[model samples]
Target: MRPLAPSFAALACLALFSAPALAHFQEVIPSADVLPEGGEVNIDMVFTHPFEGGPVMEMKKPVKMGVFKAGTTTDLLPRIKQSEIDGKTTWSLETELVEPGASIFYVEPQPYWEPAEGKYIIHYAKVVVDNYASGEGWDELVGLPVEIQPLTRPTGLWAGNVFSGVVLKEGNPVPFAEIEVEFINDASITAPNDAFITQVIKADANGTFTYAMPRAGWWGFAALVEGDEPMSSPEGKDVPVELGALMWVKTTDMSGK
Candidate 1:
């Protein structure tokens, strides 16, 4: 009986060590969330575990990339350039903002096949950049198949501000959707354990979720929903698709001069 007890303890340890990996966020981050006078905004797109800040997955050229402003969407796919980080493929875009309005930059990346999860991942990620400090047009939707419509202004936020948004699938609210939140750790912070890597929250009956930013950096909120159709894996097996509507927000710390 003593030997059996030791074996049981070993199995328990293994289970703890093999806990599920942290959440993956498709990051579409801008160099500056607010442009005081309208200038060139450099945007970086990456797919990786944001909290751990490592093991960056290879990102293929996005199928669609554009900017929505003033009730119109302009195709910016031609501006996208292939880049690399830690030898993994990423993307970058530099666009000039000359108008006084909020610009919504969005990317629809190619589906990534994840063998560990036995599924494909497609994250339609977007971020809001205010040009000339114009407050209008921050709440306009980019019309992504899945998206987060920000109830609060996505830009010019201070640390500790509660950011809120609603999960939308096909332009309709998805009741009680599951959302994963993560910070883009820049090596200045370390997680105490795996549990702290990714924070999970659920939307309310109206499909709205909110979280307070504790630090000054980029934060990602991903509303995950299962796709309606299954896609074939590279191995020719039918696998489900995980559709994520991700939005990026930046927070700044208030300092006394």
Candidate 2:
């Protein structure tokens, strides 16, 4: 007979070590959700496991970066500056908010090769910033290949309020879309386990989903969908691409009350 199989403890350790990592979020986080009078906007652009807050993956220069406002789109890629997070390449930008309305900033990052998943990932991530207290244009569609159209206002939200949106693919609603919600773990909140690291939600027949944020911080919602076309990987194998439509929102606390 062959040698005895590994013991239960040995197998358990092997399985645990071989488990895949958590989901990756393409983050487009503005320093603030609401720009006070005479305030400017600064943004952090990164790809990482938001809730775990580390081992940030490298992000190449974005393919597209722009702001949509008042029926016009302006290219903002020129303002981006190279940076690093946790020894991984990242990017940042700062822009002055001259107009007194909501500006939607979005980015299309270059295809990232994820070796563990054996696929390329491209997330079209965006965020809304209300300037000078003007609440207009927060819901405007920037016309990305994939995106989340907010049914609820994306800004000026309070903690514990429900955030809702419809997942759209090429301007049409995607039924039963899968969304993963994660918060930037800046406050040292620990998850009980891997399952609680990222909260998963699914859209209904009309592609609408909602979640009540329990904390005051920046939250990232990613709508994941399979790409129609496949891309060739470095190993010369054709692999599926994971296209993500991601959005970021911030919630405030009621401490002053």
Highest lDDT: which candidate?
Answer: 1
TM-score of each: 0.94, 0.94
* Tens digits of per-residue lDDT for model 1, 5-102: 45788898898769876688999999999999899999999999988887899999999999999999999999899999999999999989999999
How far in Å is the alpha carbon of 240 misplaced in model 1?
0.7
Task: Please give the distance, in angstroms, between residue 33's alpha carbon in candidate 2 and its true position after superposition.
Answer: 0.5
Over 4 Å off in model 2, which ranges? Answer: 1-3, 7-20
| Candidate 2 worst ten-residue window by lDDT | 248-257
Indicate the residue-level lDDT of 20 in model 2. Answer: 57
> Which run of 10 residues does model 1 get worst, by summed lDDT?
1-10
> What overall lDDT goes with each candidate model?
0.93, 0.92
- Distance from true position, residue 237, model 2, in Å? 0.8
> Per-residue error at 115 for model 2, in Å?
1.2
Q: Give candidate 1's whole-model lDDT.
A: 0.93
